[model samples]
Target: MKKLFIFTAILCFSHANNEMEALYLQNGCNGCHGMYGEGMGASPRLQGVREEVLLRRLKDLQKGKTRSAFGTIMVSFAKALDQNQTIEMAKYLSNLETKVDDERYEIEYTPAGDGGS
Candidate 1:
């Protein structure tokens, strides 16, 4: 019974993950973030981060606190998602372990809305 419950939980998690991946593709994120959010070209990789961290980051980006060359372009895309979608995407992405460590220097963002960071 314990084993069965564990299996069921895993199955449900997998199904939810698949739905989130579909959402990513539907939003055209695969074009830049790659098929697995591993990123491509100039796009930065996003994997193995905390869900809460990503949620905060997305909200910051929505307020023009992007820290990338494509920040201006990504601002619109980030805003395209509502809070719920943002949470789902962040949850899915936070679980992925990437070959790349996705290391970056931290940048502070102020709420003054001056596009800081």
Candidate 2:
């Protein structure tokens, strides 16, 4: 029974992680944050950040507040997530072990005046 319970717990955790990853990708977080929340260029690393801090920052972004010169770009993305999703994302990112990788995923950036061309 204990083994069965442990297996079930592991499955649930894995499912949650997968869901969080999908959410992160679907929201284009990896465009700036890297595939593993490692961050890229001007974006700050989200991996290993405190859950509370992430939650606060996410909420701030949702509220249309900017933490940095580039933070205004995050407003729409943060608002795209519901409150529960924001919480889950923060928890997931906080649990990530930061690693640098050569795997390249296209970064999404739109210049201020090019109209996303």
Error of 2 at 59 (Å): 0.7
What tens-digit string does per-residue lDDT give for candidate 2 at 20-117? Answer: 86678666788798878889888889999999999999999999988788988888999999988899889999998745533223222423345666
Instruction: List runs of model 1 lying over 4 Å from the truth.
Output: 1-11, 97-117
**Residue 105 CA error for candidate 2 (Å)?**
7.3
Reference-based TM-score of each model: 0.67, 0.76
Which candidate has the top score in lDDT? 2
lDDT of all predictions? 0.73, 0.81
lDDT of 2 at 32: 91
The alpha-carbon deviation from the true structure for residue 92 of candidate 2, after best TM-score superposition, in angstroms, is 0.6
Question: For residues 15-47, could you state the per-residue lDDT of candidate 1 as single tens digits?
Answer: 887667666656678678765678777776777
In model 2, the runs with Cα more than 4 Å from the true position are 98-117
Q: What TM-score does prediction 1 earn?
A: 0.67
> RMSD in angstroms, all models?
12.6, 6.5
